[model samples]
Target: MAGQAEIPADVVALCDYERHAAERMPAPLRAYVDGAGADGLTAQANLAAWQAIRLQGRVLADLRGADTGLRLLGLDLPHPLILAPVAFHGLAHAEAEHATALGAAATGSLMVVSTQSGLPLEDIAARAQGPLWFQLYMQPERGDTLSLVRRAEAAGCRALVVSVDAPVNGLRNMEQRAGFRLPEGIRAVNLDGMRPPQIRSEPGRAATFLGLMDAAPRWEDIAWLKSQTRLPLLLKGIMSAHDAERAVAVGVDGVIVSNHGGRALDTLPATAEALPVVARQVAGRIPVLCDGGIRRGTDALKALALGASAVLVGRPQIHALAVGGAAGVAHMLTILRAELEVAMALTGRRDLAGIDETVLWGS
Candidate 1:
């Protein structure tokens, strides 16, 4: 873990960490962390969509008793910014998720540990000072999935975020061009003997649609998942209003409006474009969280005005971790929280509840 003194003097904002990380990381690992689906169209759109939204600022508003605190999934979080789950933290820093857990705790931000994390889930849980949630990828067998869930439950994970978007890996061309591969001793520790062997395609048959997707999760699988865990269940990668409505109908605790950071599929609409529609479809039946292209505090406020309950910061966490380990992550989150407060004060809002569509230019 890095100390405060180790953080660079120029690292004053979240965006700055990206440049520093690119310089610090190996070329192959950097490409893997930054790559998205084919053509990189959707990933580029995510940032542009958020930047295009205009904020409406106000003057002479009361600022007393204002705070960023909010209650999410029965946890009273100090702020709405969450550390979005990213895999293979060891590729960026030596301490891996253990360092990230400490950084999140220091800033009072919730940390979602990925199913593909480099370290053991129990070890990460022990290092976290605040609440932790587990992001799960459904295994080929029901029993294998249940075992992961059981481990998460025993580790005291407060919620379960099931990623339902990608049935198979996307065509990440940038990663392929860079020849990215995980070095030895940095595999998904929890999935040592559990992940199913690759499915070989028959001659003259489709591989993805016919072979591997046979294990893809269906609606019935989600319903079965809900029955197996007492933790709050949130479905990630819900991009359509129809899917959001169906998630509510299936008795999910929440729905995350995301396009998997534009990593899972190419040419999909950005999360900023999908968030308002999904939030309206759910109609407050459950919390609607979103992740993708959130780099600034203003971006988070825009998401809330458009109807997101909270926003998740994804790639920036890794960038910060690479630059300064735990201290870098904490500083980056702290800077974002301060910016959120400034935006709220300038817009005449006292707290998170006071922020609504009115804060946006054309609400």
Candidate 2:
């Protein structure tokens, strides 16, 4: 609930918020927010991949009435950036998802609320002034997953972003090193009373192989869930052309090329690398969105040029929330949108449609 005054004058960009947030938050909390999987190769790669892409600048092109707006799944977004779903916002700010919702609404940015949100989906939906899309982690029981989808539909969620990667937690070594644990009273409120079916492994069998992954949702589960919900369904964690084609064949609404922010698995290809390939495979049959290592406006522009219809910003939302609560996050999105405009103006692109592989050098 912090006001605009809480936003520091020097915090002009998302990276600035990242630095301020580290100083403001507890070490363990920061570790949990920043940590990636083992060796951090993929996380580093995500950032580097975006940086490696070069934009082509144009001169003397008409730039009148430039726009950043776009429509996805029938929802009109003021800009192409979305607040990617991240779990347990309470770890960053006391207002938690409520603050994030207010911030997103303030700037007309769409937010995908996590299945593991610290606040109830209904409560967050009530506070959100803009659009809310629920990110679903399909449960072991079809009934349980369907119930969650029904709640989201009843709460006015515009879409369902089903995360399909990580049936198990990633090997987050940094979190382990910091001994990170969710503070008392902070939990996934939406998941309360829903118990996962037990999967016991016999002796001499690896539990992860024999039991834990048994709960992972398969392609059939996604198709079945799509049948149960009327909402536009998007599959997250898509990193390959084959999966993208499969998703299209399965009749899903959209695909988000992601590596779980490099938190799900190490050494995986960054979203920047995966996006173009997936976008090509889908062939515009569905919208392609991506998240991972998107810290600047130029990064978003790069993603779009590479075939992403829109890009999602994840960790930066937490960094902004931790630093200045709701206002901080609002300011963060404002900065990104402004930067996108600047990039577009310089690249001689009047609207998002003007952006394509042509904007990238050596395309």
Candidate 3:
């Protein structure tokens, strides 16, 4: 598995893991992994927007020992890139979330296990050697949400990432057209036995799901959630500066500027486009992380230059897991770390902290 290079060298491999995953996965799984919400404009835009940003490279500086190390929410990470939470790893491979946990730990990157994951939180934690954060979905029942949070804390998860974007699933037209559904055997083990609420397809399941979302976590609920865990609280799916400011005001430990990988809202700004404004709003009071459309080390560098403490990758790692399980994931991280180092050297930045707004052009 280590020596295999399913993807060609000339291919600007964002992560070798994804290439392997694409080769191994069937059409249905591939479509599911690749599908975005609605027309997928947001998803497509996520990548496009990053390409739109141009970097100003510096020359003649001592770039011999560049570092990608970063400290986010008090945890030291080898790089400023993290694996974003993706659901139902069982859909990608047999090892499911366990393989991903092992791979993330192998490369010293953090993993945010999804509530919709196939494996239980405890099982993934048992295999993980690095930091783990639990991604929570505010289910219809508060008890279910609370139960999951408690379970994650018990399993040694260091933080709780409340996914605020998916109040309900987005209108993923591709999945709907493909008749996508989680296979029977691969259920969200965390929510097993207790059926939360059936998504009403007749009236559009997306709407039903959105309706159930606590719709903007009230300040009190945010306060209550914070009280529930000693771990730092991070609110995901934030896009606007207003929300970022509110998040900090309410005492959030961090804010992830994401559009749920453009899987929720179709018309929102790409995460990259929204990052600088939100980062400025947060003003270093708390960590500001960006997710959605990050496919290269340069993208990570650009985000860091714009004030993001770290960047989260959503689909690429899942693609790696689909192709080669744990080994694929490790390969993908290895490639990304190397690419990030190269980007740092080329940009004349010695470390992640050195990448500031000065490196960006055209705002």
Clashes of each: 0, 0, 4
Model 1 — which ten-residue stretch has the worst lDDT? 1-10
Candidate 2: segments with Cα more than 4 A from true spot:
1-5, 201-206
TM-score of each: 0.97, 0.97, 0.92
Candidate 2 lDDT over 213-307, as tens digits, reads: 87788999988988887899999999999999999999999999999999989999988989989988999999999999998899999999999
Deviation of model 2 at 198, angstroms: 1.0
Per-residue alpha-carbon lDDT of candidate 3 for residues 229-289, written as tens digits (9 for 90 to 100): 7889999988998989889988889999999988887978888899989998999999999
Residue pairs with colliding backbones in model 2 are none
Error of 2 at 30 (Å): 1.1
lDDT of each: 0.91, 0.92, 0.82
lDDT of 3 at 197: 60
What stretches of model 3 exceed 4 Å from their correct place?
1-12, 15-20, 195-217
